[model samples]
Target: MATIAPIEYFDEADFDPFVIDDDVFGEIEDPYAIFDRARANGPVQPGTILELLGAPADSIVAGIPQFRVIGHAEVQAVMRNAALFSNDVLKMNLGVTFGDTISAMNPPKHTQVRGLFQSTFMPKQVAKWSETLVDPVVNDLIGRFIGDGRAELVEQFAKRYPFEIIYRQLGLPQRDVQTFHRLAVTLTFNSDYIRYGKEASRKLGVYFQNLLEERRRNPADDLVSLLGQLGGDNGLSDETIVSFFRGLINAAGDTTYRATGCMLMALLENPEQLEAVRQDRSLVPLVLEETLRWNGPIIFTQRMVMQDTELGGVRMPAGAIVNVSMAAANNDPAVHENPRKFDLFRGTKSHFGFGLGPHMCLGQHLARLEMSRALNAILDRLPGLRFDPDMPKPTVKGGLMRTPRDIHVLFDPS
Candidate 1:
């Protein structure tokens, strides 16, 4: 479509690696050297958005196609262009992971499949679910060590916290909670599955296949069973239902776990912010909102170019991949005043946390409710809770999904 195919393949030795400034953030990092370089050059300039797609995206290594971690208008443009650049990597990577009716689907299919889960995650549904169930569960979890003034929040609580809650919401038998949790861990943590895509896909397909059958026969009053009923309504195959459940399992399990971890870590790092919220307790909303921006759960998401197109004023071709950096766009100096600073009362409710357009996250309300409940319980109960300096820094394992492994908090429980 352009002078050359936008999805141009340059040999490793072809292009000068010195296109942009040096960034040793990780062994392999895309600080979007070209995009950022263009951004650095002028108001509007030539640049490219690099998305880690297919098996290559799974490889976290030096010299990989990580061009740059981009932000600003260029990044937003990518998020906006859902048509040319798609959320259809599920077919490439996530499809094998999440089945069919996921963010990967576009337009009509996306609308149809996503609707089945809409009622379940509706704001009202989440609210009732919270007061009746979620809140008490969180309170109980936090209340365990209220007097001890200590807890291994991540391992003992945060890690499994979202899983258990999801199980309850999906109506999975309580006993099978641990099994689903392990499956989630494997989906997110076991990098080996990433390399062996077929094996991972088969294993996930099989597990969910069995789970879907059980949910069907029992017909429990839960999300999965509801999904079971909606099976094939709009091309929602049994395979799709299975993947949706497993996808739902893998989707929130780590994001919330790491998000809650990051929230705790950020709170500890800024004592004044923590204290402010502890005193008022109402700042939880603003704090959580800011946290979603500052140390957001999702750093970047990949999309593929279906047809030749222009991105950030540069030509892009069919088969090209674009990686949208929510983190960078979030911290864009032009868009956010004092971008680096965390202001709980910033008053902006929107963010890439749930994504944008037709492919927005379906479980957003549930996630928000869960996080809000946990934050309120934490602030209300553990007034003196703060990060222990000696506490180990939480680490995030990256791939299609990114989340922290451990977030140790040392606080006086009471």
Candidate 2:
């Protein structure tokens, strides 16, 4: 039998911040190192950095118990049981002073606030946005650079699409739009640029506060305008709206940008699969799924335990900071057959891409629609498209959100 070291500590919150150190954060699942150590190690790890950051039990990061990252089922548990695992994550990352939208609201408040956004992001609304918002923008941008025959996907396509779409939806002025885009990106995943993130948040907070005032006086036709005009018991307040804008901007910008890039690259590499879909065109949705499965944009989510529980056979105490290892979970053999292989034709229903249950990505449907449209635009217009096999392969960004930093595709405008 293999000798297992007696675990020195399981409750990460008990440890002093200066003493706690976790190596798991180092093992990011990039394209070069997909699920190397993390998947093999299973879901629960006692010494993760996330748990280590929390204050002692008596002085947690917030007044609430600290949650640690864990495995697929544990992730499923938090996602599934909304009551226990609150989606109000703003409390954890962006303190209440910053903002609190539906994503940060609990139960009754969350449900009501979520509905307001839902009404704006419904299937019909998304479709309308595609027809009215996305297509025109993509066509205009590509038309400008179509003759060039090559462009950096991130700066040109992935970033621009969501930035424009979300900016318009949120009703920010054009002058302020780019700043917000840059700010959103920095706060979400640009960990290297802490000062930029802090400045961006500070500016956006002030900007949104002013915009909220404007909307109150004379609302526009956009979603934010509508949200501002709403009144009653279930309606959101200005502070809550500001929080939503902050979270939504970050969530919208990072996820869609990553999704758009990830899907396009996957389609390029998996040529046979790409060709298979391009031949029929009806398989676009399936292609998106395969792309998400092949290279999920968002890697992990965290949940705090309310009581003593067992996850993946490991007992965890209350206040454990559990990361729903989405990247590892997606590749978990128990869920998807031959997960590493990207078979667009594969028959798989559920995936950890947008996660599952109540907290499942609010912007998923819209993201899918935008990504599908962007890809179709390329496939339809640009023939003879394929990866620049000669160029170095793109690397995936880890932490908070996962995505490729570079996805270079070479093709003739045939």
Candidate 3:
């Protein structure tokens, strides 16, 4: 008889969506140390940081000469000069799963498509949603657990918060939150869980297909309705609209989920900073910015070499896949003083956490709103909020999507 391991016997129930395979890459306790060493040698390194940490490269990028750009300027150079290093390479990777979303497009085409949603995510537009959308979503989530003195926030709040907001914003029923979130998370793990990922993709595609039809017949005040309305005469195709919304879920969902957890964990670790923010709510914005700089969820993003290029005096041949380490660039000593420490007052505001150049994150304002509102709601409601004394101290895991396994915390219930 053929033998199968015990680990392979589990079902979908075993999938802890919050953890999301944080240790699948063999958890690196200090990825910065590796980046520091690589930076000391040169601004650009030969192999990807994940590979250096013992995880093998994805088959798609396996044979490519991978370069890890660590310095702030070098990272900006690559991000800014999208013409030389095209983001279209993701078309072959993420495109296979996400279709031809704008993130995977380059130059003129990218600029054109982004304009469609640019106004929606602008700071002023995003501000309108703060009261109507963001605050209500935050309070609704807090109300669920306000009576409990202790909660594993990663599972109860951080992980669930962003997905709920995203679902509601899309004009989907509140009941579908879990289903959509699971599908989104599974689809993102296409490389690891191919079977589930493909199934998730199929289900999501079919659901959107029907929803698009419904929105066309009877328009509503929802993102899907808005996207549906946009297409018809001189707008977008139904397929492009679906891909755009799919990309939004993939971009705005997991990243915010992980980032929220990271932000909360950072504050818990630094009690004095947490107290300072609690006392003066004005520091909320600074805390959010500092968190993004100190420990952003996304560690790196990939770009393919469009032509022969040299960054930081290192010549990169055409067809090379460059992994720009935003996390490393944020910690570069050249730009930030005492790069390792997390300070709310650091105030230098420039970091590659949200990326740079044309393909920078469009939903950044929305993300900031979600994080800020969530923090404010917590501080206002959860008095004496701190790490649970009996449980294991939470340490952030993973090299890529850095998030704590579970943000276990204790607080005085309202």
Error of 2 at 368 (Å): 1.0
Question: Each candidate: RMSD to true structure?
Answer: 10.2, 10.9, 5.6
Tell me the TM-score of model 2.
0.83
Candidate 1 has what TM-score? Answer: 0.80
Model 2: ten consecutive residues of lowest lDDT: 1-10
Q: For candidate 1, lDDT tens digit of each residue in 111-205?
A: 77788768877898779888766877787777776777666677767776787787777665555555455545444321234433334455556
Q: Candidate 3, residue 323: CA error in Å?
A: 1.0
Considering every candidate listed, which one attains the maximal lDDT? 3
lDDT of candidate 1 at residue 383, scale 0 to 100: 64
- Cα lDDT tens digits, model 2, 1-414, are 012111122133242211111121222444223343444555555654333332122122434434344355666776787666665454554443345656556777777777776776678878888887888777766676577667677767786887788887766656555546656765542223334445556667777767767676777677667767654455667777777677778777777887777787777777887888778888988888877776787666666666687766677776665556666666766667787777888855667788888767787888888888888888787777776777777766544455666677666753
Clashes of 1: 11
Off by over 4 Å in 3: 1-20, 23-26
Give candidate 1's error at residue 273 in angstroms.
Answer: 1.4
Q: Return the lDDT, model 1, position 358.
A: 69
Output the lDDT of residue 61, model 3.
62
